[model samples]
Target chain A: MTAVLRRPTAAAPRARGRRRMLPFSPRHIALIPIAFVFAVPLLQMFLAALSPSAELIQYPPPFIPSHLTLSGFQRLFAQSDILRWLGNTVIVSVVAIVSNLVLCSLAGYGFARLRFHGKNFGFFGILATIMIPTQVLMIPTFVMFASVGLTDTLGAAIVPWLASSFGVFLMRQFFLSLPAELEEAGLIDGCNRLQVFWRIVLPLAKPALATLAIFTLLGAWNDLVWPIIAINNPGAFTLQLGMANFQGVRRTDWALLMAGNVVATLPLVLFFVAAQKQFVATMTFSGLKG
Target chain B: MVTHTAVLRGSPSRARARRLGSAKRTVEGWGFVAPATILILGLSIFPAAWAFLLSLEKWNGFSTPTFLGGGNYAEIVGDQQFWDAFGHTALYVVLFVPASVLAGLVLALLLNGRIRFVGVYRTAIFVPFVVSPATTGILTNYLFDQQFGIVNHVLGVVGLPQQGWLTDRHQAMLVIAIMSLWGSAAFTTVIYLAALQDIPAELLEAAAIDGANRWQAFWKVVWPELAAVTVFVTIWQTVQATQLFDLVYTTTRGGPLNATETIVYYLWDTAFHQFQFGYGSAVAYVLFGGTLIVTLIFVLVSRRRSSEVI
Candidate 1:
C-alpha cells in the first residue's frame, strides 16, 4: 500500500523534467490562444480604465491605450462614493467570514461528533435548504427585514450572510475527514468538548477554515441583487451595488465606468493571486461536492 | 426533547447514571447547533414558507394584503409577460449551459496533459471566474459596444461590417450568453480538471498497451468517468442561468425591448419596481417550482444511469 502511494509522487518530478525538455508540444499549440481569449476581458478592463476619456469616446477605441492615464481613477475617487462603498463591502465581508467560521464550525462539529436525537434530521434539513433558490426567498426576506427595520440598512446586507448552510456542510465534511483520535485524546486529558474543539481540532482545521473564509468573503463581497433590493440608501451600498447603480446612471462615461469596474474587480483578482493555491483548492472542493 | 424520566424509569442505578450522561450530551449538542439552526430557520426556511403564503395574497407593498385564493397563480398562467420572460430564461439556459460545459471540458482535457506554462494557462483561464458578474457585464457592454467597442473594431479591421451588439434586440441574449460563458466556463474547467486527475494513470496506460488510440481510449474510459462532473456542472450552470439578474440588470435592464427579461429580472421588476409584491411572490414560486422539477429530473436520471453502469 505504501509503495503504491509513494510511486506517483516519486515519478512526478522525473516526468515533469522529461516534459520540460521538449521544446514545444501539441498542448501548448492548442492552449495559447485559449488562454489569451479567456484572459482578454481582465486585460481589457485594466487598459480601458487607464485610457484617456477623450480616446474612449472615439470610434473603435484603441485596443492598447495611446498612453496610460489615471484620469479615470482620479475622477472616480473625486466624484463618487466608491471609497465609502468599498468600506461597507469590507465590513460586510469581514463580519460574514468571522460569523461563518464560528457558527458553522460549532454547528458542523456538533453534527459530526455529538450524539443528539434528530441530528441526522437537522443536518439533512439544513443541507436540503441549499436547493431552495435565493430568488424565491428574497421577497419574504425583504419583508421580514423591513418589519425588523433592517431594510435600507447595512444590517440588511450583513444579516443573510452571517451563516450559510454550505459553510456548515463544508466544515462538517472537513471535521468528518479528520481522525477522531486527536480529539478523543484531548477529551481524555480532561479538556471538555468545547476546549477539545477550540484548542486541538480548530488548529488542525486551518485549511478548511481558510477555504470557508475565502468563499464567504467572495460571496459577500460580490453579492449584488440582495443588496440592491434591501439597501437603496446610498450610504449603505456595497461595492457591487454602487457600481451597478453607477453604471446605470452614468452609462455615457466610459472611462469612469471602466475605472469603477477595475476598482471593483482588482481587489478580488489580487486576493486570488495572493492565495492562488487556496483559491484553486476551494474551487475544486466546491465543484466536486456541489 | 429527549425525556430524562423515561430513561431513568427503565434503568438500574448504574444505567441511570449513563443515561444522565447521555442526556447531558444531548443538551450540549443542542447548545452547539442552536445558533446555526436558528439562523437558517429564521433566514432561509421561514422566508421560503412566507414566500408561499405571500404568493396567495394581494398587496401593493403599503396597503393591507387581501387573500387572493390562488388568483395570483391563476393570473400567472395566462400572463403573457411572465411567459415571455420564462421563454427568455429558457433560451438563456439552452444557450449558456451546453456551451460553457463543452468549452470547460475541452479546456480541462487540454490542460490535463503534461505541459509547459500549465500554471500560467490555468491562472489565465480561471481568473475571470473570480470577477463579479456585474463587473463582467459592465466590461461586456464596453467591449461589445456598437460604435466604439474593441469587438466591432476587430471586425472592422478584418473588413466585416460592424453590427449593433447589445443595443440590437436580435443579438442581446446571445451576447449575454457569450459574456456569461467567458466568466463561468473556467469553473467547469476547474471541476473537470480535478475529476480528470482522479482517473488512474494505469487504466489509460493499459488501454494504450492494448493498442487503443488516444481518442478511443478517451471515449471508452475518460468520457464515462466525466459523466458525474458533467451532470453537476450542467445543473449548477442551469440554476445560475435561471437566476440571471446581475448581468441583465447591469447592461440591458432587461431590454433593447425586454429581449433579455429573465424570470428573476421580471420578478424584481414586478415586486420592487412596480411594488406588486403579491404577484411577484407567485412568480418566484413558479420559478422555484420549475427549477425544482428540472433539478429533480437531473438527479433521478443520473442516479439511474449510474446504477445501470454499475
Candidate 2:
C-alpha cells in the first residue's frame, strides 16, 4: 500500500509516432482482440436492449440488432418502478457525497495537522477498521438497525456510508501532503483554528475533496449487499436492488432486463466520462484497491 | 486545532494566554473529530462487540435469543454445508486471485505498449468496475443465457460447441468467476498500470542492453519491481474473493445444489433469509477468523521478505 503513495504526480502522456519504441511492435494488433473481448459483452448487452423482443429470442442472438428501438426502455419505465428506484438512488448518493465531503474532511484535517491527545491512536484505530470485512459487520449491523427501526428505510443504507474509514484516511493523507505554511499564515493573523481551516485550508483542499466526492458517489451509487439486506421495501430500494429485483422477476425477458441494466449503469458511464482523470488518479492512489 | 501551534511559536506571549489557547485547541480537536469517531465506533466496533454476544446464543431473529455458550461453534464444525461453503470460497480465492492478477498484468502491459487511443481502451476496460456488481450479474446473466446468450452464439458461429454456462450446476461457480474476473481485472489493471509506470526505464534499458528479450526483461526487470504491488493486489483480491456476495447474490443465490455458495453468501442466507441470528453471527465470526488468518500470514511473510532484503 505504501508503494502506491510514491506514485508519480503526472504520468507522461504517450508520445505518439515516436519512430517505433519497441522493435517489431505489433501492439495494436494484439490489443484489438483483447479489447474486442472486453467490450463485446457490454456492447452486446446494449444491442440486446435496443433490439425488439422477438429478435433477441432468435438463435445466435444478434450481435448487431436489425433495428434499434426505445421499446425496451419504454417497457422498463412503464412496467416497473424504475423511476422511483432512480429517484431513491439519486437521493441516497447525493446525501452520501455531501455528508462524507463534510465529515471525513473535517475529521481528516484534524488528524492530519492537529496536535492533540490520542491523535495517533485515534487515527490508527480508524485505519485498522478498514481491514474488518464488511461481511463480519453485516449481521450485527442489521440486528442493530432492526432494533432501532432503521431497517427498510433509506437511513439504513445511508448511515453506514456517511464517513467511511478510507475516506478519512485519504483526506488525512492529502492534508499531510499539503504545504503547512499557508495554515501558519492564517494562524499568525490571529484567526481562530476553525476559521483558518475554513478560510485557508478547505479552499486549498478542493482537489482532495473532489477526489473523495467521486469515490463516495460511485460507492453509494453502485452499492448492493447492505441495501439488499437492510432496505427491503421496494419504495426504499436503490438502483442496484431495483435492478436485481427486476432481473429476479423478469429474468427471461432479455430486452427489458438489459434495458434496466443500462438504466442502472449508464449514469456511472457518463459520470466516469466527466471525471475520468480523477477516477484514474484516485484508483491509482487508493491503496485499498479491493 | 490549527491555532495553538502557530501562537506558541510566535513572539513571546503570557503563560496564562498560551495555556488557555492550548486548551482551546484541544477542545477544537475533539470537536472536529468526535462526530466521525462516534459514528465509526458506534457502527463498527459497537456492533462487533454485540455480535460476540449474539454468537453465544441460539435464536431466531423474532424470539428471545437463548444462551448456548460454545454450542454454535460446535455445530459449525459438524455442519457439512458450512464446510462446503468454506471449500467453495477457498477454491474461488485460489482461482480468482491469480486469474484477475494475470489478466490485469497482461492488459496493463499491453496498454503500456502505447497503442493508439490508449485512453479509450483503458476506459472501455475499466467501465465495468464502476457498474454495480448486481447489474453486472444481470448483464452477464443475459450474456450467458443458456439458449440466447451471446457467448454461446459466438462459439456456435465460430464452429465450436456451445457449452452450458449458468446452468448445469457444475458451471455455476465458473460463470460467477468470469463475471468477477471481468470487473476485478479492471481494478487490478489500473493498479498494475500505476506500478508499471513507476518502474525505472533504466532498469528495462539495462536488461535490453544485456540482450534480454521482452519476456526476459519482464521477468528480470519488471516483475521484481512490481513484487510489492503484486503482494498487495493478491491480498486485496483474496479478501474480496472471500466476501463474494453481491454478484453471487443477484446471479446464483448460491446455486442449483448450493454449488456456488461462498462463505459470505452462506452467512447472509443463514442470518437474513433463514433468520438464524445466533448461528449467523457465529458464521460471521468464523469468516472473520479466516480473513484474519489470511491477512496475518501475508503480513508476516511480506515482513520477513522485506527484513531479509534490508
Best by DockQ: 1
List, residue by residue over B65-136, the lDDT tens digit for candidate 2.
Answer: 899998999999999999999998888887788999888888877777444577777777877778789888
lDDT of 1 by residue, B148-196 (tens): 8989999999999998889998899999999999988878887887777
Q: Model 1, B177: alpha-carbon shift in Å?
A: 0.8
Q: How much does candidate 1 score in TM-score?
A: 0.93
Local error of candidate 1 at residue A82 (angstroms): 0.7
Which residue runs of candidate 2 sit more than 4 Å off their true CA positions?
A1-24, A288-290, B1-19, B302-310
Summarize candidate 1's per-residue lDDT along A94-177 as a digit string, tens digits. 999999999999999999988987788889889878878888888988888899899999999999999988889999999999
The candidate scoring highest on TM-score is 1
Residue pairs in collision within model 2:
none
